[model samples]
Structures are given as structure tokens and as C-alpha cells.
Target chain A: MNILYTKNISKSYGDFWALKDINIEVPKQSIFGLLGPNGAGKTTLIRIITQIIFADTGKVHFDGREINEEDVRKMGYLPEERGLYKKMKVGEHLIYLARLKGLSRNDALTKIKYWLNKFQITDWTDKKIEDLSKGMQQKIQFIATIIHDPSLIILDEPFSGFDPINVNIIKDEILKLKNKGATIIFSTHRMESVEELCDHIALINKSNVILYGSKQDIKQNHRSNTYTVDYIGEFRNTNGQFQITDQSETEEGYIRSNIRITNDQSPNELLSILIDEVEVHAFQEKIPTMNDIFISKVNEGTNA
Target chain B: MHNIFLIIQREYITRVRKKSFLIMSIVGPLLIASLWVVPIWLSTRETDQKTIEILDDSGFFKDEFIETSSLKFEYIQTDLVEAKTEVLSSENYGLLYIPRINLDEPEGITFFSGKNPSIEVIQDLEWAMKSVVEDIKLERSSIDQATLDSLKADIDIDMINMTESGEKAGSAGVATIIGYISALMIYFFIFVYGIQILRGVIEEKSSRIVEVIVSSVKPFHLMMGKILGVGAVGLTQYIIWLVLSIMITTGISSYFNIDRKDSLPVQTEQSGVIEEEQENEFVAEMFNSLESIDFSLLAFAFLLYFIGAYLLYGSLFAAIGSAVDNDADAQQFQLPVTIPLIFSLIVLTAILREPDGNLAFWLSMIPLFSPVIMMMRIPFGVPYWEIGLSLTLLIAGFVFTTWIASRIYRIGILMHGSKVNYRILGKWLFMKN
Candidate 1:
């Protein structure tokens, strides 16, 4: 079931349209990646979803109902430009955010303590935000994002400041949240994290969603019918029968090359040709990476 | 509603707990108390005596100059050159030189001192010389000095304001002082606390915490909460200052033994009974003047204008703060809002000059100037209808500015980076939610 959805949403600033008729849905208990290049209206769409800003014309539905003020209590948003009251202590800041998300004071305090301890940042509770390192502040920001345990969480560039170790920690936490049935919508230029964590994705360019679907389905749709084959010996000169896109001699004295099947040939048929001449070490169909697909689609969008 | 309260609570708590707030609250009262108390104490202390030496080359007015405990005059037989040398080198406060001159037209009467003498001293010397020369001229005409002196009776007018009910004693001097003070206090509070609201808004916006908080509450509510929260802080400071000032003033007055009766500089009369009776009458008249001023009404008007003007200006200040990303950007927007306030301050002197004139009447009715000019006119006895009209307009002005400011604030705080000029601000005002 979709937990949050926007229909025909558009936003404009003076003469510039920041977002235009953007329709997107975030399913329950799934990590939804919102992808866009700089100034592609990704932040604007997220702001609309989180109600930090209003959609010039559209409808936002939360849990199958029109979004209302109370719906905000069940949504947590961490904007791309991370900000905290630099003078405020970590513990105090977290508690205040939690309370603003509609948690009672006692509940906020308890949850803050739990999150601080969970992140192993309890010792830094009294330290001001400015005094913490960027990575440390990122951890605190992550904890603040979900401190109130909202059913839907929106994070923009959530991992921008973390080191690799902290990144892994946050990734694990996100997976844990997914396990606990929390829906997440995050935007980032880091495709690796999206590939690792996101189950669904949308690629927006120039105020329009050019591509969107489940992660597997979107990747599947972009894949070309090409395969890489590693073999011990070279194939016979059957250039007309089969096509080798590119070939290279490996250091292990094996011939490795990418091949595209012609004449509606199946993988088995292509394999049959290779099997007769040499020992087939490895063979696999190539699926496009998110980074390649993102670049190609954005370029296609710009060209069109 | 709950989110607004939460925002207010956060704003109030964070600000009240700040070290700056505490320091200002404690130190502001002491500063104000000293401003009132120190001057009075210093002026009341006994001052040293001064001796004036007169070198009369004319020698016609030898015994004319009199002596007082504070100012003593001595007639010395010396040439102008010797006296000039002595006066410049010696510690004498001043030297009075009377050169040989005609009594018909007195000129070249120079009083030399190391520094400029006080206006009071100059006026006293002028009065004594004029009277002595006048008596000599009258004697030349065979007119008796006694008759001339009797004819020089000083006229003292006791102004009484007549109303339909009865004639009440009135004093313009006291009323003008009170009016000036009341108007100035309103100006001070609005300027100080209005900028406080601006800074608070700018702090929230620049820090980027405004987005997180506004996500839970309406932007208008957040703006109102912040403006009201800072106003509360200002009110808190004012209350503490008022109480501390009262305490300090009373304490200092008693410590200095400033008895009203003893402090009254009542000039002695020829008859002791008349002097005592006159003193009692003056005391009663001062009390009666104070009683007839309607202090409760003035205090009520003062508070009403102070809060009304503060809210009006504070909302605009908050809007200006929201429109800009930093102080540098805010400067461009701040001028338009502050111009009216500054204009009101500039015109205050004009209002004081003609408290009952057409300019004062109209300016007092204008919502922006009403808070200041109206208060200025209040002590000088303004009509009730004018006060009511000014108040109504002031409240209406606050509501109008707040409505417009919140609209601008709702859009401005969310906007980051871009030159926010007047055109953009106007566009933002009309932008849909």
C-alpha cells in the first residue's frame, strides 16, 4: 500500500516553475529513492511532500486522506541543508524536535535517551551542535529524523557528511527501519546507496519525472540484451553468425568479451557457440547501473 | 493551536535562558535608575562659593553691587590693567570691569572668566548693572530712586485653566516635562524591543531551524509566536525596570534627606507670616496640580500606546527579518519600515512645540505617530475623542501590519539566496499558499 502520494503537483517561484505536474508515490515499508540533478525540483517536491512548503496546485494524500496539519505529526523530514540550533545542546535539540513531531515531553525524553544511547552518542548529549564533528552531527541528525518514530520519514542527502563506517551504520539503521515497517523517501546523488538501500526509485529532470518504478523493474527496463562471457579459449571466426561488441585478452590467458546476440538468439544458443570452442568460465547478462541509467536518461531528457 | 504554543514555549524558554537576556534584565534597571538618581543627587549637593572682583573705573556704582553667601562681590581700588592681570592669574571665578562710560547707553561691560560663565550668572550681572545705571539716570532727572524702585514691581501670574465645571489650577511647565518623558519612554521601548523581534526572526531564519519548526506549525503562527514571545521579554524587562527604578528613586531620595518642604527654594518675604503662608500655599498648589492631572488616565494611555506601537512595528520588523538571508540583506528592507518610526521621532519636537495645534492634532491621529505624538499631547490635556480615535486607528494599524507581515513572513522565511528586493517581496505577498 502506498503510504504517501502526490498528484499533479506543481510549484512556481515568480516566473520559474520549480516543479511541474509531478506524480509520485511512496509505498509502505520501502526505501523510495528520489533522484534528480541539481535544481531539478527534487528538494521542492520533498518540501511539498513534507508540507514545509505548499504546492502551487495539487493534492497530497497521506494514508489515503488529504494531507492535514495533524498528518505532519506522523511525518519526519530532514531537509538537504542540514541545520540545528548551533548553540543548543544535542539532547535538548533532539527532545525539542521530537516534541514538535507531536511526542509528549516524557515520551520525547525517553526516545531521545534511547536514540542517543543507540547511536553511542549519549556522552555527547550536553555538547552543542557546533562543537560536534560533521560525522558526529550527521549521526545526531539521523537520530533526530526518526526520534518520534513517524511512519513515513523523508531525508534529503542523509549521508552527505558521514564517513564510510558511519555510512554503514546509518545504512544498517535504515534497513532496520524498513524491517520495522517504516516507509522512507530519501534523495541523494550517491547512486551506490540508492542501489543498496532503495527498493523503489524516481528520476526527475528539469521539473519532470523522466523515469520511475520499482528499483528492479526500472533497472530491468533500462537493460540492453547484452552479456559478458569469460572463456578459456577463443571462439572460431564466426563474425557473421554472432557479434562480439568488444574483446580483451585477460592476464590469466582467457578471452573475455562482451557479446550481443543477433538473429533472436537465446543465451543458450550464444552459449552453445562458445561451449564448442572453449571452456566457458563465466557468463552473465549485463544489467545497467543506476549511475549509467541516471546519466543516460538525464542526457536524453536534456536532448529531447 | 498546540503547535503555536510549543513554538512560543521554545522561543520564550530559549531566549529567557540566554545569558544576554539575564544580563540585560539585571543591568537595564540599574542603568535607568542611575540615569534618574545620579543627576538629582549631584545637583542637590552643596557647591563651593565664588568671589567676583569689580574694578570700577567709573567709580559711580561703588556700593551698588550686593553680596550673597554663594556669590560675593568686592569693590577693589585698582586700575583696569592691574585687575585684568590679577583676574587672569588668580583663582577668582570671574572679574567684573566697569569702564568709564555714559549711563545713557551702557556698552563694553565685559566679564572675564577662565571659562564661559553660566547663563544665570550673566543674567544676574546684567540685571544689577542695568538697575544701578537706571537709578543714576533717574536721579539726574530729579526723580527719587524710591519711587522708581516701587514702580518696578515683579508680576507673578498663576495660570488657571477654566472649564465648564470650574477653574482648575494649571502648570504648563510640569505638563511639558511629563509629556516629553512619557513620549520618550514609548519611543525607547518600541525601538529597543522592535529590533529585538527582528533579530529573533533573523536568528531563526539564518540558523535554518525555522523550516523544521514551521513544518509543524503554520508560518503565520510561528511568526506571531516569535513576535509575541520577544514582546513578552521586553515587557518583562520593563516591569523589572519599573519596580527597581521605583525602589532606587525612593531609596536615593530618602538617603539624601530630600524633604519636599526644605528643598523648595522659596524666596524670603519681608514679613515672616507672609512667607510662611506663601510656602504653605505653594505646597498645597503643587499637590493640587498633581491631583488634577488625571494620572490614572495618562498611565492607561501610556501602556496602550506602548503595546500598540510595539506590536505594529514589531510585526513589520519580523517581516523584514524574514525577507533577507542576513543582516546585510536586511538593511535594504529595514529602511522602509524604520523610516516612519524615525519620522515620528523627528516630528516629536514639532508636536511638543504645538501640542494643541492642528499639526499635533492630525499627527496624533495618524497610527504611526499617534503612539508618540498622542502620548505627548495626553499630558498637555488632549480631547477624549481624539484619544479614542487615535487608539482605534492604532489597533487597526497593528492588525493591518500583522496581517501583511505574516503573509510576507510565510513566504520570505522559506526563501533562501536571491536578492530580495521590494519587487520580490511584493510578489511573495501575493503568492498562493
Candidate 2:
């Protein structure tokens, strides 16, 4: 079931259309990767869903009903340009933000303490935000985002200012939250994280979603009907089953050749032809990475 | 509503705990108290007496100078040069030279001193010589001094204002002073608290915390919270100053045994019993006029106008702050917003000249100028309906400005790194969130 979704949402700023007829659905308890280049209307769409902004002509649904101000309490958003009050203490800042999301004071305080201890930053509670390191502040901001135990959490470029260790820590926390039945919408340009963490992705470019689906399905659909084979013997020819697109000699005296099926032939048929002529050491099909798909789709959009 | 309350709490607590606020709160009352205390202290304190030597060439001015506690006159038998040298050599204040001249044309009289003599001393010597000359002229014209004295009359008019209740004594002078002071206070508070709202908004926007905040609460809530919070801070400071000033003034006055009647500079020996009696009467009349003012009504109107004016301007200032990236960029927008306030202050004297004139009436009805102009007119006794109309218009204007400001603020806070102008701000007001 979908936790949140937008249907034909469009927003414009005077003569500029920041978003246009955008449609996206985030399934329950899934890590949905909102992948896009910079200024691809990703932030605008997130703002619309958070109800910080309104779409000109469309509907945003939270659960089964149209979203309202009260429904926003169930959703937590960490904007790309997120910040905390520099003069405010960590504990106080968290409590304030939690309370703003409709948590009672006691509940806010209790949740703040739990989150701070869980993140192992309980000692930094009294420290002002400006005194903390960037990564530590990012951790505090992360705690503020999820302190209310929101059902749907949206994090935009959450790993921008963190070290690798902190990045992994946040990643683990994100996965833990999803395992706890919270849907996550993660927006980033980092393709590698999308590959490792996201279950579903919707790639938007130039105010439009160009590609979207489950990670496995998107990779499956972008396959080029090509395969790479490693052989130790001299590579001769295929028996009219496939065509060798490229060939290279490995440093260890092995031949690596890229082959594409020519006549609707299966991989088994190509392998039988290759086994007759060459010693087949290893064979694998080539699948596109999210990075490759993102670049190509954005290029296609600009060209169109 | 709860979110707005939270925002206001944060804004108020953070600012009130600031070091600058504490310093201003403590220092502001001392400054105001000194304004009341210093003048009376200076006037009652003793001054060093000065002696002047008189060289009379005409020989008609001998024994004409009279001595007072602060000044002493001595007659010297010497030439003008010799008298000046003696006066300079001794510890005397100056030398008064009455050159040989006709009594009808007294033009060559001069006072030579090492430094400039105080105006009071010069006026005293001139009066002494002129009185003697006038006595001689009166005798030569065959007129008696008693008859001349009877011809001189001092006129004092008592103003009586007829109200619904009855006739009450009024003083235009006292009303003008009270009106002017209250208007100035309103002007001062609006600027001070208005800028505070602007800076608060700028801080939230520049720090980029507004996005996280607006995602949870509406931008209108945040803006209203900030404006109200800062205004409460201003009110807190004002009340503290008022209490502190009254306490200090009364404490110092009682300790020094200073009475308003005694604080008046009464030079009995120099001015004689007639002028002293008149001075006493003037002070008594002023106290009576003070009692005629309706302080409760004035206080109520002051609070209403002050808050109404502040909210109106405070919202505009917040809008300006949201449009700009920093204080430097706020200058272009601030000028237009503050122009009406400055204009009212500039025309304050004109309004006071005729409180019921057409200029004052029209300006008092306009929401922007009414806070000041209407305040200045209130002490002079404005019709109740006129004040009601002005107040209604002011509230409507406040509501209108707040609506405009909130619209601009919601969009402006999210936009960054763009050069904003009035045209862009107008576009933002109509743009969808």
C-alpha cells in the first residue's frame, strides 16, 4: 500500500515552472530514492508533500485522504538547506522541533533524551549548536527529524556534510527506521548510496520524472542484451549465434570479449558456441548502474 | 496556535536573556532619571560670587548698581584704562564703563571682562542703569513715580474648558508639553521595536532555520510570533524604565530635600518682591493645570496607539527583512516604510500650533500618521468619536499590512541568493505557496 503519493502536481513561480505534472508514489515501509540532478524539481516536490508549499493544480494524498495541515505531523522533512538555531542548545532545540510537530512537552523531552542517548551524544545536549562539529550537528538534526517517530521521513541530501563513518552510521539508522515500518524518501545525487540503500527510485530531470521503479526492475529494464566473457584460449568465432562487439587482451594472458546476442539467441546458445572455440573461464551479463542511467536520462531530457 | 506560542516563547526568551538587552534595561532608566535630577541639583547648588568695578565718566550713575548674592558692584574713581587694568589685576569679574554721554541716547555703555560674562550679569547691569535713567526722565517730565507705576499693568488670562461634566481649568502650555512628550515616546518605541522584528526575521532567514520551522508551522505563525514577542520585550523594557525612573527621581528628590516650588530660581534681592510673587503664582497655576489632565484616559490611549502603531510597522519591517539577505540590503526598502513616521515627526510642531486645524485633523485620521498626530491631539481634548474612528482605521490598516507581510514572508524566506526589489515583492504577495 502507498503511504504517500502525488497526482499531477504542478507548481510555477511567475514565468518559471518549477514543477510540472509530477506524479510519484512512496510505498509503505520502503526506502524510496528521489534521484535527480541539481534543480530537477526534487526539493520543490518534497516541499509540496510536506505542505510547506502548494501545487498549482494537483492533489497530494497522505494515507487514503487528501493531505492537510494535520496530516503533515505524521511526515518528517529535512530540507536540503536545513539548519538549526545556532544559539539554541541541542536538547532544547530538539524538544522545540518535536513539540512543533504536535508532541507534548513531556513526550518531546522523553523522545529527545532517547534519541540523544541512542546517538551517543547525550553529553552534547547542553552545548550550543554552533559549538558542535558539522557532523555532530548533522546528527543532532537527524535526531530532530525523527524524534516524533514520524511514519514517513523525507531526508534531502542527508549525507552532504558528514564523514564516511557518520555517513554509514546515518545509513544504518535509516535502514533501522525502515525496518521499524517507517517509509523513507531519500533524495540525493549520490548514485552509489541509491544502489546500496534504496528499494525504489524515481529519477526526475528538468521538472519531470524520467525514470522510476523498484531498483531491480529499473536495472532489469535497462539491460542492453550484452554479455562479457573471459577466456584463456585463443578466441576464434561464434557459430552465427552472437556477435563480438569488442575484444581486449587481459594482462594475465586471457582474452576478454564483449558479445551481444544477434539472432534472439539465449546466453546458453552463445556459451555453447564460445565453449567449442575457447576455454570459457568466466561469463557475466552487463547491467547498467544508476549513475549511468541518471546521466543518460538527463542527457536525453536536455536533448529533447 | 500552539506552534505560534512556542515560537513566541523561543523568540522572547532568547532575546530577553541577551547581554545587550540586560545592559540596555539597566542603563536606560539611569539616563532618564538623570534628566530629571541633574537640572534641579544644578540650580540649587551655590555659585561663586563675582565683583565688578564701575567707572562713571558721566557722573550720573554713581550708587545706581545694587548688589546681589551672586554679584557685587563697587564704584571706582579712575579713568576707563586705569579701571580696566585694576579690574584685570585684581580678582574682579569685569569693569563696567559708563562713558560720558547724553541720558536720552545711552549707547556707549560697555562691560569688559577677561572671558565672556554670563547673560544674566549683563542684563542685571543694564537694568540698573536704565532704571536710574528712567527715574531722572520721569522727574524732568513732571510725572510722579506712583502714577507711572499705576500705568503699567500685567495681564494673565485663565483658560476655562467647558466639558459635558462642567467647567475645568485648562492650560494650552501644559497640554502641548504632554502631547509632545507622548508622541515622541510612541515614535521612539515604534522604531526601536520595529527594527528588532526586522533583525529577528533576518536572523531566521539568513541562518536557514526558517525552512525547518516553516515545515512544521506556517510562515504566518512564525512572523506573528516574532513580531509579538519583540513587542512584548519592548513593552517590558518600557515598563521597567517607567518604574525605575519614578523610583530614582523620587528617592533622589526626597534625599536632597528638593521641592518643585523651591527648585525655581528666585532671585529676590535682584528682581524685588513683585516678580518673586509672580513667579510663585505661576508655579501654583502650573500645578493646578497638572491636576486638570485626565491621566487615566491618556494612559489608556497611549497603550492602544503604541501597540497598534507597533504591530502595523512591525509587520512591514518583517516583510522587508524576509526580502533581503542582510542589513545592508534592507536600506532600500526601509526608507519608504519609515518615511511616513519621519514625516509625522517633522510636522509635529505644525500640528501642535493648531491641534484642531484641517492639516492635523486629516493627518490624524490616516492610519500611519494617526498614531503620532492623534496622540498629540488627545491631551488637548479631542472628540471621542474622532479617536474612535482613528482607532478603527489603525486596526484595519494593521490587519491589511499583516496580510501583505505574511504573504511576502512565506515565499521570500525560501528564496535565496536573489536580488529582491519592490516589484519582486509585489509578485511574491500574489504567488501561491
- Model 2, range B184-302, lDDT digits (tens) per residue? 99999999989998888888999888988888999999999999999888988998898988999999999889877756676544454665687788798888777677788899999
Off by over 4 Å in 2: A229-259, A268-282, B46-48, B51-69, B72-119, B262-269
Q: List the residue pairs that clash in candidate 1.
A: none
Residue pairs in collision within model 2: A54-B433
Residue B9, candidate 1: how far off, in angstroms? 3.0
lDDT of 1 by residue, B1-433 (tens): 7767777777778878899988887788788878866766664763355778887888777877765434678778887777878888988888998888888876778898888888767776787788778778888998896888787776667767665558778777767778888888888888887887888788888878786777667888888888788878778878877887788877987998776654565653433476668878888777766655768889999989998998899899999999888887788778887787788778878877888899998888888888988877887788788899899999999999998898899988888887888887788788887
Per-chain TM-score of candidate 2, chain B: 0.89
lDDT of every model, 2 decimals: 0.83, 0.89
DockQ of 2: 0.80
lDDT of 2 at A110: 91
Candidate 2 chain A, run of 10 with poorest lDDT: A234-243
lDDT of 2 at A4: 90
Candidate 1 docking band:
medium
Instruction: Report residue A198 deviation for candidate 2 (angstroms).
Output: 1.1
